[model samples]
Target: MHGYTQDKDEYAARLRRIEGQVRGLAKMIDNDQYCIDVLTQISATTKALQSVALGLMDDHLKHCVSEALTEGGDTADEKVREASEAIARLVRS
Candidate 1:
C-alpha cells in the first residue's frame, strides 16, 4: 500500500475541495469577475495543492523511505533516488 493510505480519505476530501475551487474559478471567469479577485483565488488554490504535496512527501519519507532504508540495499538507493526526483519536481512546480 501507499504511504498515505492511512489518510486516504482525508486526501480525497482535500482534492475534492480543490476541485470545487477550480470549478468556482472557471465560473468566475465566465461571469467576468475582476482580474485581481481571480488571481487571488488562483493563488489560494495553488497553495492548497502545494500543502497537500508537502503532506504526501512527509508521509512518504516517514513510511516508504524509512522502510527502504531499514532494508539497506539497492532498494534503499532506488527509493532515495525516487524521492529526490519527486522533491525536485515539486520544487520546480
Candidate 2:
C-alpha cells in the first residue's frame, strides 16, 4: 500500500519480463537462428533492461534523493552525485 511497495512491485514485474526475454534469447540460439536475428533479439533485451534501469533511477530521484535532501545537506548532495554518476555509466553502456 505504501509508495515504495508499489514501486518495488513495478520493478519486480519489469525484471521478470527481462528474465523471460533472456531465456527466449537462449532458445533462439539453440534453434540455430541467424546471427542478425539473434543480435536483434539481444538488442531488444538490452533495451528492456535499460528501460527498467531508467524506471528505477526515476524512482530513486523522486523518492530517495528527495527525502535525503530534505533531511541532510552535504550528505544528500553526495548521494545525488553518486546516483548521477551511476546513471551516466548506464547511459554510456
**Backbone clashes (count) for model 1:** 0
Note the Cα lDDT for every prediction shown: 0.99, 0.85
| Tens digit of per-residue lDDT, candidate 1, span 1-93 | 989999999999999999999999999999999999999999999999999999999999999999999998999999999999999999999
Reference-based TM-score of each model: 0.98, 0.86
Clash number by candidate, in order: 0, 0
lDDT of 2 at 91: 76
Clash pairs, model 1 backbone: none
Question: Pairing residues by index, what is the TM-score of model 1?
Answer: 0.98
Local lDDT at 90 for model 1 = 100
Model 2 steric clash total: 0
* Candidate 1: residue 18 lDDT (0-100): 100
